[model samples]
Target: MTVSRRAGLLSAFLLPSVLTATTATGAALAQEGKPREVVSTISSGYFDDYLMLAVDGKAKTLSGYYNDGKCRFIFRDALSPTELYQRSELGEAYVVDSWDPDHPDRHFTTTLYSKTPNGYRNQLTLEPGSRDENRPKACRNRISLDRSSWVSESFYDVAVVRKRGARVFTIARAGEKPTPAPRKDRLPPPGTGVWIDRTYSAAFSPKGFVRLNWYDPPGTPHGGYVRQEDLYPSQPLPQRDGGDEAVQ
Candidate 1:
């Protein structure tokens, strides 16, 4: 479905990437005992903009796209630790909190590791909400991997639209458009209750414009199984958590 270019629907809804909480010190590594609240607020550069891909409500996720070596991530539209239990579209929650307050609050985390020559090679893990009892059983036995690729594009501005009903939106930039490649033999399993392996590529133009490209094999009922993911690029990691600045 084509989206409206109206600033309200497109720009307002483009969930801006920003810092969640705040870190005690701007200059320090995230260690135990004194973990800082990972804030992901927008900056002056591309890290300031963020985009959202809505799929039948419940803000799936949010984040900042890669622009320079200083890759920053933003996580907005947080679902209270309990909201995960009451869902509508994105199937059942696979990652849930262990209920232990001391832990990482059982939310989504954006981890960036050493990128290899082939695909993304970082270990990013997110635990479902504590009340998410409907998580897939396999989630207990093994970890569910929903991997996506990153490009030097500008997918930072996420446009939000408050529709009266649920709508499925495939969030992708102009270049990194969305594609269909799900199903029995497809790369990412596009189905509910199953771990869908997504392949997200990116692109950019000489004008310094960047966007995201996603592959959701199971699209909507009009075409595929429908509904999935809320994008988040401004997720916190070892870098770009607090407002720490480093010389490039």
Candidate 2:
């Protein structure tokens, strides 16, 4: 899709009213200090991602199931009622990315899910995460299902470098000049791949720039800003053998 078109769609999706309603609901639930359950389903063509969140206000815990068509992953985390409300207001929380070292293909760092007026929406993270040896062996399990009945477009947030000689800015302002990022930080040439957090993109869209992270050749993570015009949405590219290679 064209950048303009995508921007328009994103603007509508991130309307202030939608975010406010979600925050208000979460706040009310926390105030009640009672147990509650929230179920969210995202249909994407033949695959559907399902999540069921059960919050125990008194116990200060949150547990849920995250089904990604291929596997049913169990998620359990300790979070106070106040923290739960705060996380909901922020529109994201930490979830197990990967538990098995044998399956590198399934690795991911962050998981984004939020309640919206229509339903809950999730953005699949393409960036891989380190294997967690502490996680239980049962954290991931295969599932079989007929997915033909599901039908909806899936959107993954990936950013492709669209301009050459693009420099990373430690800080970016709409009208002000941008300050160059530290010399240690760098971005691959145009056509290389990167990704951004949807929440950050939406929050900074009005300013015409978004902050993102990229790894140096040695795999060190660095954060900086780039002009929104320098990027276009695209699917993640395949990683080369050996450790994670920045999409080239």
Instruction: Kindly list the per-residue Cα lDDT of model 1 for residues 97-120, writing each as its tens digit.
Output: 122111224343322211222212
Candidate 1 displacement at residue 28 in angstroms = 17
Top model number, TM-score = 2
Shift of residue 186 alpha carbon in model 1, Å: 15
Off by over 4 Å in 2: 1-156, 172-186, 198-206, 233-248
lDDT for predicted candidate 2 compared with the true structure: 0.42
Clashes of each: 46, 0
Query: In model 1, what is the error at residue 19, expressed in angstroms?
Result: 38
Model 1, residue 98: what's the lDDT?
Answer: 27
**lDDT (Cα, tens digit) per residue for candidate 2, span 101-160:** 223344443233434443323332211232544433443422222323222121122345
For model 2, name the residue pairs that clash.
none
After superposition, the stretches of candidate 1 with alpha carbons farther than 4 Å from their true spots are 1-76, 79-121, 129-131, 141-148, 156-212, 215-248
TM-score of each: 0.22, 0.27
